[model samples]
Target: MTIRTARDAVTAAALYLKWLGFRDIMQSPERPASGIDLRAPGLVAQVDPTTCPATLRDVECLWLNGLSASAVSVFFSLAGYADDARAGADALGVPLFVMDLTGTPQPVNRPADELVSTGAGA
Candidate 1:
């Protein structure tokens, strides 16, 4: 589950979600039109494996997409999220995770912390 490239990050994120008990997870195609990287029943996820931190706009887009699907949103980032992004996600109730090189997801905020504690049902 080591994350050395962008593709590896996506794979790792998917595996992590599986470990969290999400079944039948669907990974978005490359250059997904919805900007979502993964989807499962009641869940929507985005993974950003670039050096730049995820931005507020990024989280908002995920949120909007999830809202359209009536699902909860989560984010995984390699370098983590911008300050504004964190604030926005917190207010929107989106869980944010910092993806470690080992592909482990570390909770970045209260919502994420709750998710980690509650796993898939969260």
Candidate 2:
């Protein structure tokens, strides 16, 4: 299955976030350079299509944005993340998610810790 609409992916990310107990989820403006794909109080997530495997640079941007906003960082890729991106998230404790073709979100790594905390605590 192929997802043609980025909005659809955003909505799906919102739904998945809702399942994860995020109540203030909303879509961010369409800014390819420096905008979050989705936002919730205390949380910020970016979504990318399967064709676009999220990279470390993407993770870094999200991490910085979240820090500036005083929120936890998250990333969602329909396909997956690069090795460095995974490492970066793990190092920084950013939650990484991958969505299916049907828009169901899957966590790439769920460390047994309670939450994806701030870098200071990570």
Candidate 3:
């Protein structure tokens, strides 16, 4: 569950978003100044999966998200960046979502039969 790189963090965020019904989630090109990760075009989510420490300014992005279009921030818990990320999100007035990589599994069941079942009356 230790995310080694930003890419790993982003991938995790993408999966979580997909689970939340955000399809075709795409990430932005890695840039020095973008300060963002995944971007779902129509969705008001500006993902910033950072392994480094966050600052007060970083938190502002969360608030910005709300002001702009109800964007949400997703952070992957790295070495010690959780506090900074949280603070940044709080300051920015955005809801921060953290994945529990070490927590117990809470399985979500999906009906396998539905994948292939075309029922007129089965």
Candidate 4:
């Protein structure tokens, strides 16, 4: 649940992507830098299981990597985030996903007003 390993994060991220309508998803949670945790078509998602606070640099690197591949950027962190990381995500209009003890991912920072018609539609 706390997602202690990259493998665990990979499973969680993959499930999250599936719920987003991605039938085929790739995961590489342990890999660093441009290494992505989940990907499908035009979406690129990454997961951070680090115990320390996720930072702005982490978001920036993920954002840059996703852009290089012309994919939408998504971030998931089990360890929460630094203020700059959260702020940067909001400014960049990215979804900042956080996992609970059950390893379920939710977009904690993506505003409800920005919500499109996600069939889950919550």
Candidate of highest TM-score: 1
Candidate 4 lDDT at 78 equals 80
TM-scores of all models? 0.95, 0.83, 0.54, 0.82
**What does candidate 4 score on TM?**
0.82
Write one digit per residue (lDDT tens) for candidate 4, span 1-122.
Answer: 45666788878777766766666677653585575777777777778877787899888887887788887777888888899999998887667877776788776785312432351233
Candidate 2 lDDT: 0.76
lDDT: the better of candidates 2 and 4: 2
Better of 1 and 2 by lDDT: 1
Candidate 3 colliding pairs: 59-88, 63-92
Evaluated with lDDT, which candidate comes out highest? 1
lDDT of each: 0.90, 0.76, 0.45, 0.72
Clashes of each: 0, 0, 2, 0
Task: Judge candidate 1 against the unseen true structure and give its global Cα lDDT, from 0 to 1.
Answer: 0.90
Show the colliding residue pairs in model 1: none
Q: 1-122, model 3: which lDDT tens digit per residue?
A: 34455566667766655655655677766733545566564343333444454454654653465356544443333323356555555444344444344321121112112211321111
Against the true structure, what is every candidate's RMSD? Answer: 1.0, 4.2, 9.7, 3.1
